[model samples]
Target: MLKDLSPQAFFMGLLTAFVGFASSFAVVLQGLKGVGASDAQAASGLMALSISMGLCAIVLSFSTRLPVSIAWSTPGAALLVSAGAAVGGFNAAVGAFIVCAILIVIAGLFKPLGRAVAAIPAPLANAMLAGVLVGLCYAPVKAVSFNPAFGLPIVLAWLVVGAWKRLYAVPAALIAFAGVLAFGVDIPEGAFASWAQSLGPTVLLVKPEFHLASIVSIGLPLFIVTMASQNIPGIAVLKVNQYEPNPGPLFATTGLFSLFSAPFGGHAVNLAAITAAMCAGEDAHPDPARRYWAAVIAGIGYVVFGLLAGAVTGFVALAPPVLIQAVAGLALVGAFSGSAFAALKEPETREAAAVTFIVTASGVTFAGISGAFWGLLAGGLAMGLARVARR
Candidate 1:
């Protein structure tokens, strides 16, 4: 392992961790808060997720000698945002998180279960994810409306940098957001004291509260999105790069970490889709076998960032909510585009997919269930009827 270490691998590893964390943490924070977490609880959740995913990545890379990157479920967080507060609030959400983690573990251990998730119509799954993202995707424009002086620069930074180098665009937006917060936004008197107090990291162990509504609304959708958008794609990326580590154990390992973190208020952790490409690609190292070192280093980097979760969360907390949301929106544009394209690509399923997308994006709630579950249900019905008509 020592012999495999190289400067290129180290740099790529650090870059991957930095990009992965900086780009979408606001989404995570917002998701936690959306599900009724207090500021302290949200910070704890963020810290728990960061540390769990980081350790999962490290253990997997070292054990399998494959660049298996783990990350918090960004799409799952987006699902929470759409779901709003759970019927029973944060504790209920935490219970749902645990249930999702257990399901992930079961999927890994049981072949049929994993296959069942994979068997969900691709169009419906993609459409559902696309719908979940709609509200957040509108944040940039809304931010501009709220305060052009504060929001325009962030959008411009993302656009200009994205045009030149797509990967760094969100980070650029994040930096611009920081600039706006520091200079443009008004700080309430005594905010400095609060910010200072928040700098020290804290973790709270939340007791899980099981509620059928939360399980249906948040848990089930979170599990599906994490599997479809993150875990499955992550494995595909590794395979495309010619590394074929067994997926079952890797999924199980991440699920275990998710379970461990749930009591600390974290949502699901799963295989990283985007950053996995960075660690598995040739850019990490010319030799494929040694690329695992990059993932290991990236894991280390994530752990370091996890330690600073308090400060990061505190700083962002002081910013205007729209500004922070603008950054989150910029971070997810790529995901939204990809999921939307995938959902609509197949002519046969296009109508059903559209139904799913519309329903999910509507952000409707009925009988204590979020639209995500209903969207999938409606799309499935639409698809079934379409098939029957053809028959």
Candidate 2:
């Protein structure tokens, strides 16, 4: 197996990890904080997610000899941002994460359940995702209003870099945000010393507290988005590159890892979508069979990066809240645009999709259920009535 490894594969693996970790970690932090996680807890969640997904990728890729990348569900984190804190706060959110992970496992183990989830209309799913992301998408603009001196640079960095090389855009914004934090924002004395002190990896277990409202509001929607936005696309990316691993086992493995990480405040770890391309593509290696090495190496990179979560979280926390949010918003713009475009593409479902998007963007909460659930329900009803009318 060592004979199969190449320098190109190694480089691509490290690049995959860098891009994956740098791109949307702020979203993970923000989402954890949104769900009532203290800074220490959010740091723990980030570390847990990073390590879990890293290990997951290593195990799957090494065992199957496929470039199976793994990642936290960025969309699920965004959903948490919109869903707000659950009735029982962060512990309840942890319980919801466990429920979502278990659902993924069940879907993987039971073909019927998997098929049922797969049968959800793509337009509705995409619309719901689009809705959840709309608020965050506005962060870049809002950041500018909060302080153009600080935020403009971040937005411009993303725009200029994205126009040149779309893949590096978010990381560029992340760098710009870092610069703003270091030079533009004033940090309290000794904060750097404290952050340095907290540089090492640490885990904090959050005892789960299950509540019906949390399960309905956060868990179900989280499961849906993770499957639709990340897991399915990850499988498709592998297939696109001519690797056909059984989707069931991969899903189950990711779910198990996610389950393990949940008590540490991690939301969901699943097959990666964007980073999957990096490890699975020709850039990783010319020989398709050898690409798995890239994924394995990337897994190692993620673990190393995970160790720094405490420092990263601490540094970002010192900046104005809007600044980190701007970076996260920049990271998600591509996803939001893609989902919105896909959701509205089919003429037959366009209206229903629109309805779903509107309801989700409204951020409505009814009977302790989030807009995501209600939006899906409303869109499903709209499509059902349309079908009946056509009949």
Prediction 1 TM-score vs. true: 0.99
State each model's CA lDDT, in order.
0.93, 0.94
lDDT score, candidate 1, position 310: 84
Backbone clashes (count) for model 1: 0
Estimate candidate 2's alpha-carbon lDDT, on a 0 to 1 scale.
0.94
Flag regions of model 2 displaced more than 4 Å: none
How far residue 60's Cα lies from its native spot in candidate 2, in Å, is 0.1
lDDT of 1 by residue, 1-391 (tens): 8999999889999999999999989999999999999888988999999999999999999999999988899999999988999988899999999999999999999989999999999999999999999899999999999989998999999999999999999999999999998898898989878888877776899999999999999999999999999999999999999988798998888899999999999998999989999999999999998999889999998888887888888898889898999999989999999999999999999999999999999999999999999999999999999999999
Candidate 2, residue 267: Cα displacement in angstroms equals: 0.3
